[model samples]
Target chain A: DVKVTQSSRYLVKRTGEKVFLECVQDMDHENMFWYRQDPGLGLRLIYFSYDVKMKEKGDIPEGYSVSREKKERFSLILESASTNQTSMYLCASSSVKGGYKEQYFGPGTRLTVT
Target chain B: SQQGEEDPQALSIQEGENATMNCSYKTSINNLQWYRQNSGRGLVHLILIRSNEREKHSGRLRVTLDTSKKSSSLLITASRAADTASYFCATFIIQGAQKLVFGQGTRLTINP
Candidate 1:
């Protein structure tokens, strides 16, 4: 079975504070993604990494950035946390073998920016 | 922007009844996938249907895709209370490098 684990299940940060959310996958997948889920917006992609030290911006990449220094780890960074940035952050990973393969997701981190 | 939109944003049904959710997309897709998320948890991959395929099933879940209308439907037969969750349909567009665009999802409730 594939396992994706997030660094924190819940987090709280003050305004303008820096925040980091980490994700690790054991399946050795080549593709990793970061997304923020809101009530009406669903899962909007923030950033994704296809390989080590490689990143791509998703639809809603503003106010957020990501890092993929190693194969198993992906980190999402918030330069200045704001109340509007509070949401359920999800991490997912998928293998690149298939054209369109299933993505395994980690238990989301509910971030509260106050 | 979201490429898919699910209909009947919320649904309620008794146990043993079937639950159906519809998703419609705006663009061509290489494949469409369905995911289930329990409250406060991440999504679980349920099923995937390619653009060339019309329907596929796994255990109690049935998925149908219509490329002409750019729509898909997921049916859960004999839904149990444990089946209660949010169902989201995501499209894998070819433009991006296997990036998935997801819909708002339909929240399902099954009463015992």
Candidate 2:
């Protein structure tokens, strides 16, 4: 079974504070993704990494950055968090072998930017 | 913009009844996948149907895809209360690196 783990299940940060959400996968998957879920918006992609040191911006990448220094770890960074940034952040990883690979997800981190 | 849109944003059904949800996508897709998320939890991959396939089933779940209409439907037979969750349809676009574009999702409630 594949396992994806996040650093925190819940987090609170003041406005303008820097925040980091970490995700690690044990399946050695080549693709990793970051998404934010909001009511009526579904899950919007923030960023994704296809390989180590390779990153791509998804539909909504504003105010967010990503790091993929290693294959197993992906990190989402908010340079200066704002109240509008509060959301349920999700991380997912998938292998590159299949045409339509299933993405395994980590328990989301609910971030509250106050 | 979201690539897929789920119809009947919310649904309620009693146990032992079948529930169906529909999803429509705007662009060409390599494949369509279904995911379920319980309240406050991460999504679980339910099923996937490629563009060339019309229907697939696993356990009590059935998925149908219509490429001509760019639509798909998920049917849960004999839904149990545990089936209550938000169901999302995600598409693997024909152009991208297999990144999934997700729909807003349909909230399903199963009454016991």
Q: Relative to the unseen true structure, what is the C-alpha lDDT of residue B42 in candidate 2, on a scale of 0 to 100?
A: 100
Interface DockQ of candidate 2: 0.87
Candidate 2: docking tier: high
**For all the candidates, what are their Cα RMSDs to the real structure?**
1.1, 1.0
Q: Calculate each model's fnat, 2 decimals.
A: 0.88, 0.78
Candidate lDDT values, in order = 0.94, 0.95
lDDT per residue (tens digit) for residues A7-104 in model 1: 99999999999999999999989999999999989999999999999999998899998889999999999999999999999999999886657899
* Model 2, position B1: C-alpha lDDT score: 47
What is the Å distance of residue A55 in model 1 from its true position? 0.1
Mind giving the per-residue lDDT tens digits that candidate 1 earns over B35-93?
Answer: 99999999999999999999999999999999999999999999999999999999998
Docking model 1 quality class: high
Report the TM-score of chain B alone for all candidates.
0.96, 0.96
TM-score of chain A of 2: 0.98
